[model samples]
Target: MEKDAFAQQLPVEKYTRNIENKSIFYVIRKEGDLTKPNFIVSYAWGNYRNDLVMTMFGRLMLLMVGLIVISWLPCLGIARYFTRPLVQMERHVGRMAERDWHEPISTSRKDEIGRLAKAIESMRQRLVRQDRAQQFFLQHTSHELKTPVMVIRSYAQSIQDGVYPKGTLNESVGVIMKEGERLRYRRPEIKWEMDLAPHTTLIGDQEQWKIALENMLDNQLRYAKSCIRIVVKSQSLDNENAVKGQTSLSKFCISNDGPLLDQAIADSLFEPFRSGGDGQFGLGLAIVKQIMDHHGMTVRAANQRDGVSFYIEPGKQTDKTSVPKVS
Candidate 1:
């Protein structure tokens, strides 16, 4: 039984051949003394060493690859986290520039990109408000202009038919009633004061100036708590821009004792149908602006301690006789 077990442990037989000769060798060893050997075995040291080195090298390469993969995971996550918001922001800004009014992006990130997103969203909201205000302006403009036009047309037709239209009398009555109603309704009993520049005139359509003044008065009436003042004065000219014989400019100001206008509202007041305090469409000021533009005059609104003032500056000189006096 001992000999059989030793045979099972022995190395398989092998041989090597060379040009010189063929030979056989067995690599064997005994656990005990060589002289009293109990077991021996054949082994190939060169092949075994080669196999071991190959296995070790393959394992080392696998370890390097795994380490690289593990390290790359966190790097990839960080890069994506930082750049994703930036990419989204770029796309969103492009859309806004194109005037695309899509819903704003929602984000809760507490980073720079998040702040940028919030700012962009705010701008979009402002644009939306303006857009809504523009729609309101169009609707109001249609209604306001249509009534007057229809009434004027009807009156002209009736007059052409040789009929002394009842409108002529009714219109006068209507004006009187409107004035009476305004006096009763306006609070604080607004006083009217006029400081006219005698014979201050420009070469422009008188009718247009009348319309501009009426519009200004209408606005002042709506807002005035105590008094409305109209002042006309000659503006001294700069020597460089004025012709030596040119007449001085006539500066007209309409002021009211009312609440001061906000700086933002004052800046954009003359823009057609701009939104105003209480969301009222500013068509009155717009009309004033249009008439002023036609006559080559500049108009601006300014805040005062007690109220607001609007000034109209003439663009050119005209003979003093051309200007009409205000009652």
Candidate 2:
């Protein structure tokens, strides 16, 4: 790969962006390979002389000089309005390379730069959505398996207490044992909720949705103290969802009594490979972000007067109902 990349960087005899308005293949052969003969030749597949690059060298150089002039101190100040955003974007990528996404690329432009800014903002939001979804998935997955596990724990103790005879209990009791084993290795727990409004069934990978929801519930159950609340409400104009132009949504929140994490720490919660808080791979939230990105949703964290809360906000639906569950 490095060799291929370096080969592309080799000084061009002549380089010109003003090629034929069509794409053509550029073929190169190994040095001194005499499959046919030893000759220096080049060709093009589009109209216009293939030698245009060679002749246009002067114009290209002038363009370069013109750019240099345009970037001079006085001109630079004026150009900063356009170039600043791109420079920020480049810096943003560098931060992203270091596994940072909390800082967004900033821009104040109404042209092409604005479009790029919008794109980056959209990407940031999508990423946030994915992270939240992932956290929920892993948490629920761990939670779902707990019930059968507890059953086994209970019955095993019962058998030791001689609560039921061995002959009469072997069949159904054996089933419980099998289920315990199945759940023992599973991560997270399973939780369910139902509401009458009937959040219109969304067309999606049903399996993925179930896993994600379960993971969220698991996270809540694990972190929550006594009570956790979840509310699936219509995407309403009264909420921030309206600002983002969201129509229908499934908002899942898990409020806990635990001390709210500072923004600096909480911001890092969804990052992959980041284990910021106790009992956390940090991949769960990352996965949630990915799933939410695919589904066009948003997630946010806030500290309420009573406790800390995290919300999953979904968008995209004209009219729909919601099914919410609370624990």
Candidate 3:
């Protein structure tokens, strides 16, 4: 067993000639005299303490064993460190695949592997920024179209309800046409906003910002009974990466206070089509979130004891506008 333990640490050809059928075994025995009641002093495998010389067949076998060990043994050991980062990288890749980017390569080592890890992490962050941008693009478009629709829908309903005088039918139609034109023209302004800033800047779209602010305020106005607190602000965290670094941000945020959203609902409050009140369409907050993202800001909703608060940050809103992309 002792010999076996040693051989196990080695490869197949280390102790045997053939990889197919191997020869290696260990035994245990008792110590003292040989004649001591069937007791064995010790045990060994192919025990010999002399130089092994042999014929061509035997020499060929030994040569093969030497080559295998010399070539591959050291490789296995070195490969462990090289493979370690790759394994960790694989884990990170899987996590990212699951749409998780909360963690990045904080590795500070200066090596090829370390550099590769940082590069991958940087790429991931860029994708995250893109996500925010896409949401803003969509949100801007939807909100612009919704405004006129609201006005027209209201007027149309009012007319049907006898609230409109007989001579005002033409006025209602004119207002509807005006609202329709705004939707048709300004609706695509989101795409125009996106083209104004380079992606590396992590820029924000003004269209998206307005949509988010309106959503928060609208929600508060609809459900808060009376008071609705709305706030918009921007700031940047200093980058530790600078030789003597600066801040970087290109966006803003909108927050509001109302009845506390349920914990479960708040967690997913930014998701589209999610509602928490008596009954709602649930798209309001989702759209707000979508717009905030395009502008490279994060959206957070939390239940304040008396009401609720949401926060926003601009992609380029930070005072340190020169922060590096990777640490």
Among these predicted structures, which one has the highest TM-score?
1
lDDT (Cα, tens digit) per residue for candidate 2, span 1-327: 224323443322322333457644443333443343222324354444556775698789999999888779777787986787788888876776675777766666789878987897788776765666566657766687677777777777777787753455786488576876674323233343333233333324556566666656655655655556666655433433333543334565666665666777578765665543554454556676666565656666677876677777775542222422211
Count of clashes, each model: 1, 28, 21
In model 1, how large is the Cα lDDT of residue 177? 50
Q: What is the C-alpha RMSD of each candidate to the true structure, in Å?
A: 11.9, 25.9, 19.8
Sequence-dependent TM-score of model 1: 0.52
Clashes of 3: 21
For model 1, the superposed segments whose C-alpha errors exceed 4 Å read 1-72, 94-102, 146-191, 199-218, 225-227, 236-247, 262-273, 283-300, 303-306, 312-327
**lDDT on C-alpha atoms for all candidate structures:** 0.71, 0.59, 0.58
Q: Estimate each model's TM-score.
A: 0.52, 0.37, 0.34
Query: What is the Cα-based TM-score of model 2?
Result: 0.37
Better of 1 and 3 by TM-score: 1
User: Per-residue lDDT tens digits of candidate 1, residues 1-327?
Assistant: 244435544333343323345333344444664355455456444555577899999999999999999989999999999899889878888887887856787789888888988888898887777777888878876776666556666665666675545657666445445544533335457898999765454546778778888888888888888899998887544436444544444688899988888888889999876766656876778898888776668899999888899999976444434544232
